[model samples]
Target: MRVVHLLRKYNPAEWGGTETAIQRLFEGLRQHRVTSVTYAPSIGSSIAADPLTEAGFAVKRFRACVPVWGISTERKRQLIAVGGNLMSFDLIARLLREPNVALMHTHTLGRLGGIALTSARLRRIPSVVTIHGGFLDLPESMTNNFRNAHRGGLEWGKLFGALLRSRRLLKDADAVVTCNRKEAALLKEKQTCKRIVVQPHGVPTSLYRKDHRESAREAFPSIRDQRLLLAVGRIDPVKNQRWLVEQASGIFRRHPDAMLGLAGACTDEAYGESLKRKIDELGLRQRVFLTGGLPPGDPRLIGLFQSAEVIVLPSVSETFGLVILEAWAAGTTVISSRTSGALDLIQHGENGLLFDLGAPETLHQAVDCALLHPELKSRLAATGGRVASAEYDVTVLAGRMKYLYDQLIAEKNALRNSAG
Candidate 1:
């Protein structure tokens, strides 16, 4: 089966959860004789000159806009930093002309998604969109943060591309896929007759076989002598790295030799700067280490996961916390905010742990619980490893997706024949 993925922006140099999830999915897809061609906008000159081979898939990047051309500095930052969600009409035209496209799968939600849906209708093919980020269940403060973070004049790209066409995408999509049940239900409320599919992101299960603790500790000298408490995600306000820093001091008070590591790229420069300032103000310069973003399959990332005592996810909104499963696959204990994603994957004291996202103090309390109890960590690690290997492996996830694709294609052919 052949499929095309329409994405808003994909820069491997500045990778995030969405990029990682798709990359892992492609691994299983290739094995199942499914080839995926990805089309996205070239945001800045940041994307590689040859995005196809560089991105490990059939990638074709269409130009969205000129860099630093006809825009203010703040607008440029918003466009470059968080991405302006500009649609490439050229890319859409090219998408409609592609040959032998059995189905279209979109991972974006704006004008780009609308283009995919429109083309699918014109071609008599089925198209589905996956909501990577959770929006329906987001709290008021987080919803405001998303809106205010990129608010500015002179962002015409945003006006014409993402904002204006968002509702149309929702109304016209053939099917809506979500990474978690809550988001699926939310889409159902929006379009009750529309098909809603729930497919959780997955991880490689092989990483759990061995801890690699000794080598991992040796590689990172900073954490060699200290107990490691790690948080993996982009440095953004939504990811809640600042709250993790605020809770770090309390953890330090208990385990004085413990060190906190923040791994992932700095997607939001303003938010990234604020995190550094907060860390210094709280006198956690030595206790907290911020490693800039690392690429997928990086050995250091594998090491960080294998060696860290506990992996924490303190997101303001997470649809399906893929990192939680990655931690479990690495044979590490897990803790996350009580988002729908976390609640779906973790059982309070069973495979993983969950804390309230609203109460900042609860993070400290959860950290305290794990620090003193070695057995809790070990039990979670072992049980989590079993669950991740059995259910969340990428290969297993690929089978489910292939079945869905077959069903969609069969239904589309039947309808076409009936109309004829």
Candidate 2:
């Protein structure tokens, strides 16, 4: 089966959790004899298409203009900070003529999303839309700021957008997927979709278990000491990396050799700048390391997980924490915030430890517990590793997805026969 994936933009340099999850999902889908084509808006005149193409996926980049259809490479930074990028309506033509696109699967919500859904409907193909990032799980203030009802392609398209909003993607899709169970319930309450599936983000557990420590240590030498505490995600307000740095001083007092590494692209440049300033203010220049965004499935990422004594996730609003499974695959202890995702994935003091986000001191305690109590860390890693290997592996998740896809396709065919 061939699926067409739609997104606003895709650049390895600006990779995020959604991109990684989609890549891993595709990896699983491939095992089921499924192929995918990704479409995203061109960054002004440049698409940076080589990354996805070279990675062995078919790609089609639609041209877009700055402010409306696209953001210039220079302004892309600013756009990322504020969290709104536009896509052109002209992309619908590409969808209409898209060859052999048996199904449409959108990992993002934008003009391209509505177009993809519409195109799939016209072609009589089942469409699936996944809310990869559960923005609704974010703090209300953050949600309001990022999801300005009047902004994005909606504002740019004006009357046309009013006529056909992206919200239709949610209502019209044959299946709506959410990584977070809470988000799925909330979505079902708000939108009357045909189906809702809670498909958690997955990774290649077997791949992560490999021995890549040598290369990883070379890339980030701090791993050599094996006293690293890592936080992986975009440097944004919602991620709460600044709070991680703020808690560093107390952590340093307990374990002077401990190093905190923040790995992600800076989506919020202003927030990123503020983090740097806070690092300087706290005099954590040498202690807290900011390793800019690494591509999906980079050896360094797995290696960092392998090398870390404990993987700490301090995000303020995480719908589903993929990092928890990754830490399990790496046989590393997990210290996660008490968010919906973390709570769902972790069994407190059993598989992983969870700390209150409002309490930085609790995070400090969790970190100290992992560092000071070797037995607890080992127990946590062993149990979490088992869970990750058995349940959250990409292949296992993909099996579920294949079943869903088959079901949706069969239903669509039945409807066509009925109409005929």
Candidate 3:
């Protein structure tokens, strides 16, 4: 079956959880004989090779805009980069004219998702929408940041959003999928009739099987003798890299050998600037290393994961902590904030440790727990690795998805036959 996967933003240079999840899913789907095509907004000036295209999947890019007026060029660009409610007539036209699409699966919501859903309805094909980020279950602070993104701009896309029924996307979709159970529960409350699938993001265990520790050490000699506490995510306020930096001094007091490594591209330049200032102010220049945007499955990236004593996620919000699974696959312990994703994946003291975002001290304590006990760290990593291999493998999850696709297609065909 040919399925068109829709994305609002896709930049390999600025890769994050959503990009990694889609890439892994595509790899899994290939084994099921599913023909996958990706549709995304063009990344204007990025010369970065489309990783999906390089992997032999058809990736089509269409022009999209922020759909707002009276906003500065910089402001408009920021909105687009950080989950702007983009509108694209070109995307709508492209989907309408495309042939033999069995399904339309959207990885984003808002105008773009609406376009996919509307087009699927027009073609009488099943449309699926996946919530990559927390919507109904977002924290108040994170909600505020989204609202403030375009606060002063004149949003001219409300009309287009209404025309495409963007607000009703969840209700209108053939299936709604989220990685976090809490997000699914909250979505069910709002749209009781929707088909809500709670699928945790998957990882490829093979790539991380080889020991890349020596390669990682050679690449960055400074971390050779230190116990690395790594945080892998975008350098954004939501990822809460700044918060991790703030806690570094205290973490160092207890474990002086511990080094902080923040890996990922900087999506928010302003937030990125602030993070650098905070690091300098705290006198953590020698202790912290900022490795800008590493591609998924990169030997160095996997090596860093394997080298880390603890994988730290201080995110204010995470729909599904994909990093936690990656760390697990690399056979490393994880300490994360009590986001919806972390709470769902981690069993507290069993596989990984979870701390509250409200209580900063709790995060420090969780780190202390993992760092102080070598046996506990090894136990946690071993259990987590087993879980990743048995439960969250990409190929296994792809089989589950193929079943869903086949079921939906069969039901649709049956309805058509009866109508005829």
Candidate 4:
């Protein structure tokens, strides 16, 4: 079957939840011998480059303004506007013309949704859209006020315009998929869709095994002596990295030997700078280290997971936290925010610790508890590892995805045959 994966970006260098999810799904589709193609924006002239592989699938590049002129408040608004217009018209036309493209699975629902809906309508190709976030549920403070005020601006009209347009796309999709049950509930409440599937993201267990720790430590000497606490994700406001820093301060007050390591690139430069300033202000500059971006196979990456006392994800909102499963597969205990989809996978005090996202004190307490109670850590790791291996392994996830795709395709074909 021919499948096209549509995403805003495909570069691994720019690490985000959506990018990681799409990469894993693409890899899974390849394992099933399905013909997969990826369509994303060009990397342009920046330090960031597109990482799509040529061996397994074809890569289609579209020009969209992003990460340039800075991903500032104003730039983001403009990008969204331009993206919605171009994608709905030009990109949609192009995608519909692709021969033998049986399915177009979109990873987002803003401007990309417009493209997917348009393509599906014009070409009669079945399309699926995955909801990675509650874009429709975003608070009003984050909306583009200045753009709304400008001429040709709908004012309060722009926000409603985008929301209505997105709803139309969601309603038109052949199948809708979400990462967790919470998101599925939200989708059902918000949109009228025919099919909704909940498919959690998976991680490769082989990438993180018991024997890789020593090799990982050898590559990063600084973590050898320190009791490392690792967190990986974009350094953005929604991720609540500041909350993690505050929690680290409390944890360090108790155990001065503990250190926090942050892996992943900053999505916004201003936000990244603010985090660095906060670290300095709190006297955490010595203990908190930000390792920019690391390759997927880098030993230091695996070692960070293996050697860490506990992995923490303090996000205010997350559709799914793939890192939680990855850490568990590496036999590492986790302490994540209760708001995340990881909550569905982690059993508090049984598999791993869970704390309220709003309570930094609770997070700090969980960290201290995990650090002091070695037996609890070991038991959680062992049990969590067993759960991850049995349930969230990439191979198992691939089979599930293939079955879903086959089922969706058969239904689409049957509908067409009935119409004919």
Candidate 5:
């Protein structure tokens, strides 16, 4: 079967959890004789390699724009960078002309997702929407940011949104997939979709089981004998890197040899600048290392995961924490904020440590526990690794998704035959 995957934004330079999830999902889908064609917004020609193309999937780029006027060029770019509701007439036209597509799967929402769903409906095929980020489960702070982002401008695209029924993406899709169980439950309550699948993001466990500590130590000489506290995610307000930087002084004081490493691209440049200023102001310039965006499965990135004493995630609102699973597969202990994803994965002192976002002291205590107690750290990593290997492997999750795809396709064909 051939599936067309739609994305809001996809740049290798700005790789994140969503991109990695799709790449890994496609990896498993291949075994089920499923072929994929990915559609994304056009990118700059300066990019050297396309990871999706390298993974042997066909990638097509379409012209997309923010459809809002009176916003500065910089503002427009920022809006697009942080999940703007972009409109793409080219994508709709392309999907209409595309040949022999079995199903349309959208990794995004808003106008793009509506386009995919509408096109699929017209073609008499099924549509699937995967909620990579939380929609109904977003924190108030995040929702406010999104609401206030493109204010004082005319959103001329409302007409297009209305015509496409953009707001009804979940309602229109045959199946809605979410990585968090909480999100799935909320969607089930609110949406009238045929199915709501709670599909946890998966990792290739074998890629992380190697001894890559030496590679990490060689690349980051300062962390040679230091206890590494690593955080992996894009540098954004949502990721809460600023909060982590604010809490660093106490951690440094507690463990003098500890060094904090942040690995990912800077999606929000303003937030990135603020984080750097805070790091400098707090005299953590020498202590905190900002390793700009590393592509998934990079040896150095995997090495950092393997070498870390504990992986720290301080996200403000995470639907599913893919980084936690990667850390688990790497056999590293995890200390995470109590987001929905962390709550689903970690069992307090059993598999990993969970701290409250409102309580900074709890985070400090969790880090201290992981660092000060060797036996607890080993037990946590071992247990988490076992869970990742046994349950959250990409192949297993892919099989579940393939089964859902087959069911939806069969239902659509039956309905079409009856209509005929």
Candidate 6:
């Protein structure tokens, strides 16, 4: 089967979980002899492109302009929101003309949705969309800001109309995929789509396996004698890193030997600087280490997971926390906020620990529990690793996605034949 994976960006170096997820899916599909292609917005006129030769997939990039204001991280997001619509509509229309193109799978609901809707309607092709974020379900605090920005740009009505049309596209698609059960439930409750499938994200088990801790420690000697507490994700407001910093300050009062490593790139520069200020204010300058983004195959990342005593994901809202699986695959116990998508993966006291997002004491206590009890940590890590390998492995996830694609293709063909 030949499929087109559509998104706003495809730069793996700058991408977060969504890009990784797409890359994994493409690799998996290639293993099954399925052809895949990716489309992304180009940064400028000088489009420097590269193909995933290993996975046998091609990437097509187009140029678009972006604004510079508000949070630095959000600037890129805002540009994609503008560029994806223009590019997707044109790109999808052209791609649909190719007879071998069986299906178009789109991720996220921003500009990609508009393009998917346009392509599907014009060409009568089968399409699918995956919701990776809750942009449409923005919190009350951010709703006004989001709306005002759209209105200021004279895009509020057009974007809303496009969203309504996109919903129709989702409703009529062969299937709509989500990263977790919670997202699927939300779609159903809010009538976002008629067909929704719960397919969680997966991790590459081999890279994040258990037999790498000693080697990992050798690579990063900074935490050699300390109790390492690790958190990986873009440093953004929604991630609630400030909360973690505050809680860590209190945790240090009891366990001075403990250290928290914040990994991944800072999504918002000002916000990241603000977090640094908080660390300084609480006198946690020494205990907290902020390691900026790691390279694609950085052993330091896997090392941090393997060496850390516990991995924490404190996101206030997450569709699915892939880092939790990565930590588990590395044989590290996890402590996540109760409200996150990791809640589906973690079974408190069984696989890992869960804490209330609202209560700093709950997080502090969970971290303390992991520190004081080696036996519990070992059990959680061992059990969690096994579960992660079995359920959330990239190979397994790829197989499931391949099966879904095959089914969608067969159904599309059958419908086309029946109509003829």
Who wins the lDDT comparison? 5
Candidate 3 whole-model C-alpha lDDT, 0 to 1: 0.90
| TM-score versus the correct structure, for each prediction | 0.92, 0.93, 0.98, 0.88, 0.98, 0.87
Cα deviation of 127, candidate 5, in Å: 0.3
Greater-lDDT candidate between 1 and 3: 3
lDDT tens per residue, model 1, 1-420: 779998777776668898888887777887888888888776555544433456578887776652224556656555545534555557667888888898999888766777787778888898888888765767788667656544444445555544335556766666777889887787677665357778888888775455566656666778886789999998988789999898888788878889999999888788889999999999999889888877776678888998888998999878788898888888889989998888888889988778896787787778878878999889988898888888888988877887788888899999899999
TM for candidate 4 is: 0.88
For each candidate, the alpha-carbon lDDT, in order, equals 0.78, 0.80, 0.90, 0.73, 0.92, 0.72
The best candidate in terms of TM-score: 5
List candidate 4 segments past 4 Å from native: 46-51, 65-74, 77-89, 135-165
Model 4 vs truth, CA RMSD: 3.9
Give per-residue CA lDDT, model 2, range 323-413, as digits (tens). Answer: 8888899899999999888888999989988899777778888998889999989999999999988788898898799889899999999
Estimate the TM-score for candidate 6: 0.87
- Model 2 segments beyond 4 Å from truth? 44-51, 65-77, 80-85, 147-154
- For model 3, residues 115-219, the per-residue Cα lDDT tens digits are 999999889888888889878899897788788877877899999999999999988888888898898888878775358898888999988999998888888
**Can you tell me which runs of candidate 1 are displaced by over 4 Å?**
46-55, 65-71, 79-83, 146-166, 208-211
- Which candidate order results from sorting by TM-score in descending order? 5, 3, 2, 1, 4, 6
RMSD of each: 2.8, 2.7, 1.2, 3.9, 1.0, 3.5
Candidate 4: pairs in clash? none
Please give the range of 10 consecutive residues that has the lowest summed lDDT in model 4.
80-89
**CA RMSD (A), model 1:** 2.8
Q: lDDT tens digits, residues 1-420, model 5?
A: 999999999888889999999999999999888998999999755678778999899999999999998898888888788779999988898998999999999999999999999999999899999999898898988888888877989999989999999999998899999999888888788878777888898999999988888877787877888899999999998999999989999999989999999999999888899999999999999899999998889888999999899999999988999999999999999999999989999999999999988989999999999999999999999999999999998988999999999999999999899999
